[model samples]
Target: MVAQLMRSELPVLIEHFHLPTLPIDPDDVAFILCADNGKATHLVSYDNHLLELDDRYQFRICRTVEFLQDPRVSQAR
Candidate 1:
């Protein structure tokens, strides 16, 4: 599954994120940092730390189901 994901077109790899990022959990910061640094359109997660931050940054946070249900999401894909 991981290999397949690496081959997928939706996800992109980022080299690094500049400092002075969010103040949330250091462990979970990567996810937010990735979205922030990449200027992502959407962030999908089951974690509350990230979900609660829907409007806090450039991206919109939602679950897998919500993402799939959105017409805009399909168009983006």
Candidate 2:
């Protein structure tokens, strides 16, 4: 799946992006790094480690339902 995705134009092939320094877990940082590198307007996740953040980044982070119900989320979609 990863090989196929990398071959497509999914924009998952981030090269020189720098990861953000968050107090959360290291693995969670990867999620943030990807979103940041992709210049995403939002960061949606189920992990408490990512959701419980102090809302530090310019991007917004929320759970599944929170993201779904948010009218603002439509802009992202």
Candidate 3:
């Protein structure tokens, strides 16, 4: 599946946005920024800080399993 995705046209390269002053962990900022700048619908992770920020950002923050179980994700598949 990974190889197939790599060969497919679903992957995109996006530029990193400037850091924001978030209350969560500093190291997790890049993930949030990437999702925001890329206009992603979800940001999947297992980090407690990121999960705690579920409703704060434009994108939905969730665990990997939750993301996989999402109806939208299933529909995409």
Name the top lDDT candidate. Answer: 3
How well is each residue in 1-77 modelled by candidate 2, as lDDT tens digits? 98998788686633443544473576676788777778876788878888777377767788777778878777767
CA lDDT, every model vs. true structure: 0.74, 0.71, 0.79
Total clashing pairs in model 2:
0
Candidate 1 per-residue C-alpha lDDT over 1-77 given as tens digits, one digit per residue, 9 for 90 to 100: 77887778566555465644453655677887777778877789888877867766767789999989878889977
The candidate scoring highest on TM-score is 3
Candidate 1, superposed: residue stretches over 4 Å from native: 1-23
Per candidate, the number of residue pairs that clash is 0, 0, 0
- Candidate 1: deviation at residue 18, Å? 7.2
lDDT of 3 by residue, 1-77 (tens): 77887789695543454534363576787788889889899998888988888888778899888889999999999
Question: Arrange candidates by TM-score, highest first: which order?
Answer: 3, 1, 2
Ranking by lDDT: 3, 1, 2
Candidate 1, lDDT over the whole model: 0.74
Instruction: Report the lDDT of model 3 for residue 24.
Output: 53
